[model samples]
Target: MTTPKPRHLETPTETTERERCEQWTDQLFRTSPMVRFMAKHLSLLDCNPLSPFPSASASSSSTSCSSCSSTNPAPAPASAPGQQPKLVIAPCPPSIAGGFSPSLPNEPTSHSSILLCSNRIFSKSHLEDTLSHEMVHWFDHCRFLVDWSNLRHHACSEIRAASLSGDCGFAREFKRRNYAFKLQHQNCVKRRAVLSILANPACNGDKQKAERTVDEVFESCFGDTRPFDEVNNPRLNFKATDEAVY
Candidate 1:
């Protein structure tokens, strides 16, 4: 006979935090141009990302993809088809801000969802940043047929996410004490990608291995920004004028 592990419960404070975070996350998903754009693009794709990870497919964009432009632009996308991925609020390990999870092969009907850490997120900005970061992973999975189980593939996505999600903006990079002006953005992206990749169980907490994986795909992955036109332009501006038409 085996005893089941005790179930942990959220205290009042934790529950309040969770609810607050969940509400904000919902609002962000609704109002964030970046999130909405990616969601719309994912919906336009024909494949199911959770359906046992298919071989790499050709990327697709709709006729209205350029609608995200504000002087600059995102790829053109026209209309919608599939269901939007869900944004789930749940407890996460202290070290993790959030995670992107794809349903197992056995659950063909299920799709990938993003999990936001209620306790770890301190403000709306943090929540937006976390959500945007995870969305990049989701976008890559749907558009590129990424095998999340593969370390190199995982590292590439992480690098692309961190690089393209506005996670390494100048101020944030400066705060991290990476003062070298030369290649600061690239360095910040690589360092953050390594941290994220190391969190994966497959890396076994091996920093060196994680760094190596990130390096191998850094050039190509960092340069490949899809669903968006460029880095630092996640199209987070949710203003009505900037919003992409679905």
Candidate 2:
């Protein structure tokens, strides 16, 4: 069976949400301290909501290497490659947007990525939190820190995102419900991490691989916290630059 592709959001309401996303993404690179600090290698670009997703860079054979035969796939250099240049912000179908990686499927993503999203359901603050989560993934990819093919790598990133971002915050959770007793944040992070990891079909359709991978990396990834000690707010201050912010 052919997998259904993500539908592009185009309704009147969706258009407004898309406009808001573009503004927020631009603001993030400009003001977000954590994002700017971590994303030194990446260059922020002007994005058009109507523009198509950034095309994948083609790996053309190096004609410069006269020593190798033209037919042979040029041997990959030993050194690690550079980070994907820009983080794209695009609108995706409701099913895939908000929480999914704009990274290409089944790929660790050596090239650029899309920040596929819509602000219809989530607030501006919520959107920033989500962007920060993806940015962590971008940090890992750019630095060649992990083998993206490995399920454990993905699981570890998810764990870090949940633990680092306010995704598992007590205030966000208890906003509606008046729970008598306070709950531990770790439990929330763990549960959210599992759900995210298991969402990947590449991790084997919500079965053993995804769960086990999370379990194996849970201690290490959850324990390995950075940019924050443990669940502190990471809001950024946006400064106006030469380019006008919408």
Candidate 3:
């Protein structure tokens, strides 16, 4: 007999957090031009909701779209042919703000799932950054031949995610006190990429292995920005100039 997956009842606080995150996610999907562009182009715009939490709800609360001024926002166009992956708001490891899980080999067309940690995300910007970061993984999954099991492949995607998702933008780095006068953006991307790669089980928590893999993929992955025309996606509030430390 197969063992059952564990389930948990959400506390009142957890429920509140989940609802807030779900609303923000829905809002970004509907209203953010960059998010909409990526979702549509990547064919990940429509996502069925799934969760292991007991309070899992399949639909988000109806909120008017500010862009269209419509009480009922128009539904996203149907996803490309396949079993579309879900967008889940569930508990993740305390350290993870969000993640993307690729579909199994048998389900090639279906991209996979994007997970948002209910307890880890604190504000709208945090949610936005996390979603965009995970979407970069989704983009790589769809557009490239990614071997998720390979450390170099995983490192490449993480590096691209960090560079493109505005995770290492100057303002954010400044806030984090990562003040380096030279190659600040590159340094930030490398640091974040190594940390993210270490989270993968294949790295075996070897910081050196993760760092080395990141270096191997760094030059190529750091230069590749496909869906977005450039690094630091135009839709992000921070400008490219902000990345300059001088």
Which candidate has the top score in lDDT?
Answer: 3
* Residue 240 lDDT (model 2): 22
* 1-246: candidate 3 lDDT, tens digit per residue: 111112246677777787788688767877666565555545432322221122223323222223321222322332233323256666666778887878677765343767788788988777877887887787787667588889999989988888878788777798889889699989998999889888789999999999999999899989877665566544564233312211
Let me know the TM-score candidate 1 reaches against the reference structure: 0.72
Lowest-scoring 10 consecutive residues by lDDT in candidate 3?
47-56
RMSD of 1: 9.6
Model 2 regions lying over 4 Å from their true place: 1-9, 41-85, 99-110, 119-121, 175-183, 207-209, 227-231, 236-246
User: Which digits, one per residue and each the tens of the lDDT, describe model 1 over residues 110-182?
Assistant: 2665667777888877777777788778767766667877889999998888876767777666766767888
Top TM-score model: 3
Alpha-carbon local distance difference test for all models: 0.63, 0.50, 0.66
User: What's the C-alpha lDDT at position 128 in model 2?
Assistant: 60
Tell me the deviation in Å of residue 72 in model 3.
16
Candidate with better lDDT, 1 vs 2: 1
* TM-score for all models, in order of appearance: 0.72, 0.62, 0.76
Which stretches of model 3 miss by more than 4 angstroms? Answer: 1-8, 44-85, 237-246
* The 10-residue segment with the lowest total lDDT in model 1: 56-65
